[model samples]
Target: MSESVAPVSRRGFLAGATALGAPAPAVPAVAQPRAGIVILIDRNDPHVMGHAISYSGNLSRYFTGKGQAVPPIEVVANGLGIDVFRADKSPLKEPLATLRQMIPTVVFSMCASSKSIAESRENLTIQLIDGARLVPFGIGRMVELQRKGWAYVHG
Candidate 1:
């Protein structure tokens, strides 16, 4: 009598192996930089700044989840974005408050020329932190930051 042997397929073998509770293969961990991202906000509208701020905050959280460190982010406002700096004219109360909670995590920068215009031409009382560095131009500052190896993100 000839003995019959069942043909074993690769899938069957794998199934049997899995049934034996074989450990899963280890995956190589990917290395990511712990550097922060620089977000440049140069909107001329309060609503736009609010949206930009929200975008920055969301991006920061996303980078943190991907095992990457987000570098210091600065939201430089000039032209019309300075409206958010004003107490009365500011329309982004909620967004600004959320940004304030991030505090030192995110930096705020305003254009020197815009502030000058606000004071001299508009006569508006705008408040900004001392940490907010004033630059001669906002777009130029963004380019400078990019040239300095800082990742430039615009909202």
Candidate 2:
């Protein structure tokens, strides 16, 4: 007589493995980062800002779909990128607002140096959209965030 074994169902296999102390699956750090991420935008293009927003939103969706908490995300703008956050001139106001609504923890920051230069060149006070903050130096902020273990993405 030949020996025979019954097929195991997925659930049964999992249960058997668990009983044997098998480790549970782990999600990647990027999917549910503990230290969060920083998105850098250094251009004066609306397209780049839109793309950064989309990328941030996608990151949010990725982790949330898996029932994971979104890590803190900061979109840091420098140089001509400062214009993207202008309250009066930006064409991406709606998209930026939408991204904020989706990820309340997401932050928008502009470089003070850039803003000052733009103001001097244009001879007008540049007001950032509500909730957008100004950092002393964009590069410094990036480095600080990195020092704290936050992931950086150039958008």
Candidate 3:
């Protein structure tokens, strides 16, 4: 009886070699924690945006000092606050631009109802980031955030 040698498939050998030669996929070393925070801004009030920005700055500095990660902060702006989010014509343009640069992690939630009012009454272009999550009402959003385990500080 003659012993026969098994034939190895070229494709299978090449695939195994390629897989072994490749380096392990690189992973990000920093870990991000899930922190939820809600900040309510009274847009109808003339002083709200200034206060909110100041509060945000303080909160960010506090978190940095503590050596702990800050939660995602959402600033819900309605009524007059929406003015900050308005297209080029906003009076708070310079302030908003500055705030945006400083707090890149903050989410600015503009009220859709206010946008509708702007469209009908003033023909204002409410420039918002695409597909932002809408709360039933700006106040409702504040309540919702509080109920959903988010820390709330009204400024």
Candidate 4:
């Protein structure tokens, strides 16, 4: 004798689970309309820069794919994170330049204070990537963006 197995539908399973007091699965939050987004990177590691770049690219793609306009994105690098913007020391120069070209609305900002400090401490001249802008202060820039209703992400 073969044992018969009952087929379970998705609706049945969910209803049964709910009836058993099992919590419902969470749904992802919908994207909110915003002026723009700013990403803050304060680490000196190349990995941090890579993550920032990847996240920025993904956000841009997500909005465009969803038929929504992509918002302006800015990556503000300060503290040790400023190293990722240095042409001579950074392994990300080429990739940064390419990303700048590929994403028109994405911009990279390097902190002037951090560059000065690094130059004095490390005794090395720092050259930023072609499209990177020199901001007076990375933290200040982030604050400014936040005040303007831009979403902030720490990477």
What residue runs in model 3 are displaced by over 4 Å at the alpha carbon? 1-35, 129-136
lDDT by residue (45-129, candidate 2, tens digit) is: 8788888989999999999999999889999999988878999788888889988898988999999999999999999999999
List, residue by residue over 1-155, the lDDT tens digit for candidate 1. 99999999877877777789996445579665444456655566655676677877787788778987766777777786766555556677666676768645777777888888878886665676444557788777777777666776666
Give, for candidate 2, the lowest lDDT window spanning 10 residues.
Answer: 24-33
Worst 10 residues of 4 by lDDT: 24-33
Local lDDT at 76 for model 3: 83
2 or 3, greater by TM-score = 2
Choose 1 or 4, whichever is better by lDDT.
4
Using all chains and alpha carbons, the TM-scores for the candidates as numbered come to 0.64, 0.77, 0.64, 0.75
Clashes of 3: 1
Point to the candidate with the largest lDDT: 2
Give the lowest summed-lDDT range of ten residues in model 3. Answer: 125-134
lDDT of 3 by residue, 1-155 (tens): 99998776766666666699965445459654454777776655547767776777778788889997766778887776666555644555566566667777777777777678777897655566432345557877778778777888776
True lDDT of residue 129, candidate 3: 43
Give the residue spans of candidate 4 off by over 4 A.
1-34
